[model samples]
Target: MDELSDADLERYARHVILDEIGEEGQIALLEAKVCVVGAGGLGSPVLLYLAAAGVGTIGLVDFDRVDRTNLQRQIAHTDAAAGTPKAESAAARARAINPAIRIEPHDVKLTPETVERVLTPYDLVVDGTDNFTIRLLLNDACYLMKKPLVSASVVRFEGQLSTYRAFEEGPCYRCLFDAEPTEGLVPRCDTAGILGPVAGVMGTLQATEVLKQITGLGSGMVGKLMLFDALDYSMQIIRTRKNPDCPLCGATPAITRVGG
Candidate 1:
């Protein structure tokens, strides 16, 4: 465990003052490692807060480059960084916020061969991507890796978030979402158009869940799904259960291993 330096004490004084997250929790944040799989809207707040909270090492993975259109919600990237890789851009902002911690930029595509390697080093995984293939891939990979996955997605006026740790007999993502949505069945955020802060709301909550996962503080959201309707300003927590017949974490499992 890393001890808090005089500077760390001063820097995180607000956090250190909290009875729940005193010096011990500050150290836990400083010693923790997290990987955020997207650098888009949701990933923006997740990465930035984790950095500001002093997560020891933050890894960002994205193959896309920043675009001017992304400026509306991808808050991590600046206009000058429009053409740079999203992961690198996001990492730059995180490092700027807290140079005390390490930020790794994985500017690579997610392949079956690379998913495990990409996720292996981190203590937790945050999914902010909208692609169904990558989402399912991450769900399966995280379960196989026995790592906790904090995932969030925003589309139009609503978004949802969840934390999964199936290896501990908790509900895996697959338990609730057994199959990927059929292609074209669900519209992309680009076409469907998201309300900007909806991403921020969910991502901020995701970051909170990440902190909770690390420090063992507050209610852990392992077996619950949070749904927020930005249009009506309503929020609900729905209980989740592990499925006995789900392919991934079921009694008779079909996905014994991850990847092809």
Candidate 2:
């Protein structure tokens, strides 16, 4: 908990003026450490907003390169960055947005072998990855590390967001999804033809949940799920409870390690 400096006060004037996020909240934001996985659709807004909010440190993890197709929704990258690594591109944009913050780019794919080493340093983890395997890996690792994870996904016209703090009383991602779906069971946004703005909506909501968790200004999405249907322009939040049968966070927890 550090005090806000003159530059911080000026840079975050609007946030400082808000009753929910006054000087102290701004200070909290400045001291927070967050890791965002993926630099594609959902991660674009997550990184930008978190940087503009003055979060002191951010870890960016992505191994892919930016392509022309990514430009439609990955706002953090431009034509100039095409063919560049996504993590590096996102880090550059974040630095350009707020020079005061520190952005660490991990240009490597996250694996069961590497998950803990990559994610344990951060206080919070935001999951914007498109794969179910990575999502499950993050959930287990975050639960084991006692780090909060804000996860969101968008495919076609549908999106979902939730926060998992399984070290507490709430359900982990595995509680909602006991195991990874079979290969090809879930369609990728690229193949399914996702609307660009749908990813933005989910990513922005993911950033909002991150800020709320950091500032402690309001109730978070823990133990709840937010579902969005972009086609119908409707949203709904449903309660999700810890499952006693969940292997990761249940009474008889069996997921003792990242890969186990």
Candidate 3:
């Protein structure tokens, strides 16, 4: 592991002072690689904080280009980047935050075939994607790769966060939602509208979970879901358990590959 640079020491002064995340923990963060599966609302703060915290390598996957409406929540992209690709915009911001960090931008959607190929190299995966299809795919890919996944979702004023390490015996995302919700059941941000700061709160929490896992500071939400109600400013914690019949991690498994 490389020692902290003087600049890093000063930039992360507060983190370095904390016994939970001293120079040693910071070094561990410098050697860690994390993949973020979106560059939109939930991804904005997650990418920013993780990069500032000195995660050694970050992979950003997104194929969308920036739009005028994205400014409300996608903090990484600016007016100048309104027409730029989301991943490129996010990667630029991440690089600006911490040049020492290596950011690999995948300017494409993560299909089942490409999921494992993109995710296998990372130490951990952060699911900031909005749709259930991408979320389930990421969960299954992480399970197959035996990697830890920090998943978070935000819609309107409410959001959910969970961490899954199925390879370590915790429940996969499939255990939480047996099957994908029916179409139109949950409105997306574009259709339902979202409070920008609400996404910030959830994304920041997701980044916190990632850092906690990286530094081993506190116990992660490995088998629990954190529900945040921005309107009431209340948080609820629900415990989760592995399902023996879970198609992905069960005794009689069906999912054998990234998309299977």
- Whole-model Cα lDDT of every candidate shown, in order: 0.91, 0.93, 0.91
lDDT (Cα, tens digit) per residue for candidate 3, span 72-116 = 998988889988899999999999989988999999878987887
Measured against the true structure, the TM-scores of the candidates, in listed sequence, are: 0.98, 0.98, 0.97
Candidate 3 TM-score to native: 0.97
Q: What are the per-residue Cα lDDT tens digits for candidate 1 across 1-260?
A: 65789999988999999999999999999888899999999999999999999999999999999999878989999999999899998998999999999999999888788999999999889998989889888999998888899999899999999899988957888788767788888877788888888889999999999999999998888899999999899999999999999888889988877773
Give each prediction's root-mean-square deviation over alpha carbons: 1.0, 0.9, 1.1
In model 3, where do residues sit more than 4 Å from their true spots? none
Model 1 ranges with Cα > 4 A deviation: none
Residue 180, candidate 2: alpha-carbon lDDT: 62
Ranking by TM-score: 2, 1, 3
lDDT for model 2, on a 0 to 1 scale?
Answer: 0.93
Better of 1 and 2 by lDDT: 2
State candidate 2's TM-score. Answer: 0.98
Which window of ten consecutive residues has the lowest lDDT sum in model 3?
Answer: 1-10
